[model samples]
Target: MSDRDTTSLLTPELEPQMDSLNPEPAPRPSRPRQMTLNMGPQHPSTHGVLRVVLELDGENIVSARPDIGYLHTGIEKECEVKTWQQVVTLTDRVDYLSNLANNLVYALTVEKLIGDIEIPSKAQWLRVMMCELSRLNSHLVWLGTHAIDIGAMSVFFYCFREREDILRILEMFSGQRMMTSYIRIGGVALEPPRGWREAVGKFLKQFPSKVDEYDELLENNPIWLNRTKGVGFISLEDMLDLGVTGPMLRGAGLKLDVRKTEPYSSYEKFDFDVPVYTDNDVYSRYRVRLDEMRQSTRIIKQALEGMPEGPWQADAPKIVLPEREKMKTQMEALIYHFKIVTEGFRVPAGEAFQAVESPRGEIAYYIVSNGTTRPYRVFMRTPSFGNLQSLGTLLEGRLLADSIAALGSMDFVLGDVDR
Candidate 1:
């Protein structure tokens, strides 16, 4: 019952072994420290049903992956089933904003396959004018939406107000605003509607002032400048490697425009400068597109002033739709019209690719015909799909808040991307 007896009892019998009670701790599995976020298949800022899988570390993006196909319409395969002329309608849906550009490219491709069918000077000039107008329509939408995304609400209103004028002009010509389908294979759908000159001329006259208004609102605004000026930069080399085109490419100081370089639909005859900037940021893109709108206005003005006097459509009676007046009076015209409506005109066995400068960039159609009424193969090289390739390069290493500005600068249409 002394100290030795008490210590021996406590040490041997009463004490618990800590080592036996608890086992060794397991190590955590190796993984990245970044947080993953799915920005959208529904996010308004993503610009469409595009889902971006973002890997972020403390609000800085580590990497970004864009998920598409939500807007896919199987348009290429659908083109195979449609007749030569009927495919024009399908082209309209591919790039809804630049539907006329799509129409012209498809028409030009088909015309190349058909061989040596001359498009009249008047038709060529008209195509130039309409496509320029379509370019204005697209740039306006981009400006409004992009400005609003950056918290410049008033710029959006100003842009859309002018956009309404362009839409009215389109409606006057084609009887539809967005998807005109007015540019047919051989020529336009209808004779230029009455007062088209006055309407288009009026719009062109006032459009430069409207662009100046947008510049006044956004070009010098501190918030707009801070949000966009130094943000969303991708290298010219990266853009070229990734097939980026349009304002995004031009903003990087590359003077590549399909209208200027390739020259389809009489674009060569109309003179306009391709806007280029060396900044390669969202602000540069905005400036490039704005300048493009001004250039489009200039081309449209030239087209209106110097519209040639000739047949509106080509001389190919079989390929071009007969006039309503001619169809009523002549048996041959009536029969040809009936045959064309029921059985589409045959294109010679060949393959052709035509590229046009769409609002977003170089939009091309590669079509193959096997001496059939329908296309054997139809493939589109859409600008949105190309421009979207730069998203990862633009978003990575940048703050998450800047992603919206980066996305807006690309100006990609979901239909154009997923088609």
Candidate 2:
């Protein structure tokens, strides 16, 4: 008591709690501690096994920390073990929603490394069409799932209806819906499947109206508007600093699409507007992706109409596989096919980075070839990883109820994040 009185500025009567050391724990402050919550190593809204640690002051989020790596497949290190062609399958698993884009970028990097390899015009156009469809497929899933996350459950059904059509198209080409890996180095996996044009034409014709239907359902709905608009705001400067791209960057009004800025796989030939929104909120990201679906339909229509008449693969027999029929009859073709199947083609010694605009964002593959059938080093600069870095920025100081909208707005694939 005497020590406290000597140290206190006020008189002994005014020296409130008496002892400074261990003063009855300050009566527990009469306030609750901020509750810490783990939102998904398996939460549906997370889109994958993404764990976000949130500190909540009542319903308001005090802070959020994203804990990732639960879905890590070690794909990059695994790429080093696979042949040049075999790595495409690994890339497919990197972003489950956008396998075609993965195939295209990795193939493009290999093509660049090989040098002087001419991808046929038909193949390029086909690649463009498939990739754009992939973009549509991805956005549809994002729209459906994100809508459901925000409680617009009906939109989810409509979005999945359209997504089924796109997946059917993919299956027609690759025999697998999600991991088609159709886009291959120097060409596509197959000459566009028979009746592919008719199938695509059917889907494209009905797709626009369906998109309009989604707008009808959600564009003006009060709940959707309330949950998304003016929520989860991150400045354009912050987005750039965090390396956020795709619709996230576009929503910030940056217009920084790798497709437009650095067109690959004949993307420069397409005429489609890059959707941009200046609001930089969850609603803005939603609008940008919806508009992107329309633009993708536009590109697909153009691709189908101007579909080229040429080989579907380059004239590199050593690199590209001969037809299955050719393998059976022609001894020379059989030998080459066997050789390519058993031992992958050797890429020239060099390094190349090929970045493509995937559904999520910029998906680039950096390949270092040491004159080997397998990559000496392979690295992926995935957009989900970049976009995930901004989760804290989006969630901090926001309401807990808004977390789903904020997370879904990023449209990140956990495989892409953890790869």
Candidate 3:
């Protein structure tokens, strides 16, 4: 046989056998076969401008990637050029759920930087009363809306009904329902209103019973239980890695609370407990926040009962705006008010960090100044950003139904997350 003919015959037969022996390219690992679904800068499940990219295999979410910055307001950057006094106003928008808490943290930071201003005991205690009520207000919004997200309609109305009373009490004191920038650097925005004590006291008396109602409606309800009990469970290891705090951490049984650990705004003086759970699931988180609402009521009652009476704003003319009457009568008071409103107040060049136990978690502000009318820099360590990281981890392997339950447990406010 000719050599060329023999080679051609063997090439077709032997090439097929040789290719089979080379491992078939390992099938390219199948590219992992994930279906990516974008779940909102608009979807209802996200709760805000937060968009989560879900990588799924059928009904199970194999991975959840959180796409943030949709609601970024640049509130932090805007504060840098504003005077220290003006920055307090910016803090109000950071976490609207706990605006007072945000104001309290920022004010404390600026106050610490400018040395002590002799904040009155009355002012300090009033901050306590209002802040706890603020926490209760935040939880009500979270529970009601979260329940609504999960298809429980009753919790929404019930929680909002109580929230309205709290807001009314807030308005009586500061003349604003939600953004009561009442907490100032040296003291409150105003003295406790004439009827605030009675209003708050009545609410306080009944708020605990209302919380019991939330529990009655959802605690053991078969639908709620099925949706939340084991869904969105995040282990301690994952939580630590993700930097999640507040109810999310407590839900995992860590019992780490800034109020208990660091004790700000005279939090140590109050007798309250930080609730914890070992389950680390959606229901555990709901339970922890609900318990926090109860504890907050207790603290508020104590504050109202022992409420002190004194000057509401600080004596410092440089920081706090003088009274309107004094501004007209006294040249110095008038000048100080003009300077504070126009150029903002100056602080001694220094740095300070103040953290508060906000309803969602540890809300902190790291402030720095060059002793000028405006802040050199202002950075917020918001709780929502920390809590958002766990979504991907918690959502992985969860069914689509469980995604919402887990998201609700996070109690994320994109306003805070994006700020």
lDDT of 3 by residue, 1-419 (tens): 35554435556657655654676733444566778888988988677898889988888998889999988978978998776766778898889989998999998888899896878888888888888889989999999999998889999999999999999998999999987888987898886767777798789888889999999999768999888887887789989898888999999899999989998778888899989988988889999999999899889988988877778777899888899899889999999888888887778898999888899888889988998888889999999999898788888888988888889889989999999
The alpha-carbon root-mean-square deviation between model 1 and the true structure, to one decimal in Å, is 5.6
My TM-score estimates for the predictions, one after another, are: 0.92, 0.92, 0.91
Query: Model 3, stretches more than 4 Å misplaced?
Result: 1-33
| RMSD to native, candidate 3 | 6.0
Q: Scored by CA lDDT, what does every candidate get?
A: 0.90, 0.90, 0.87
Residue 221, candidate 2: Cα error in Å is 1.2
Alpha carbon lDDT at 204, candidate 2: 87
Could you give the C-alpha RMSD of every candidate to the true structure, in order shown? Answer: 5.6, 6.0, 6.0
Candidate 2, residues 142-245, lDDT tens digits: the string is 99999999999999889898899999999999999999989888799887778998999999889999999999999879999999999889888888888888
**Model 3 TM:** 0.91
Between prediction 1 and prediction 3, the one with superior TM-score is 1
lDDT of 2 at 345: 89
> What is the TM-score ranking, best to worst?
1, 2, 3
Q: Count of backbone clashes for each model?
A: 0, 0, 0
Worst 10 residues of 2 by lDDT: 19-28
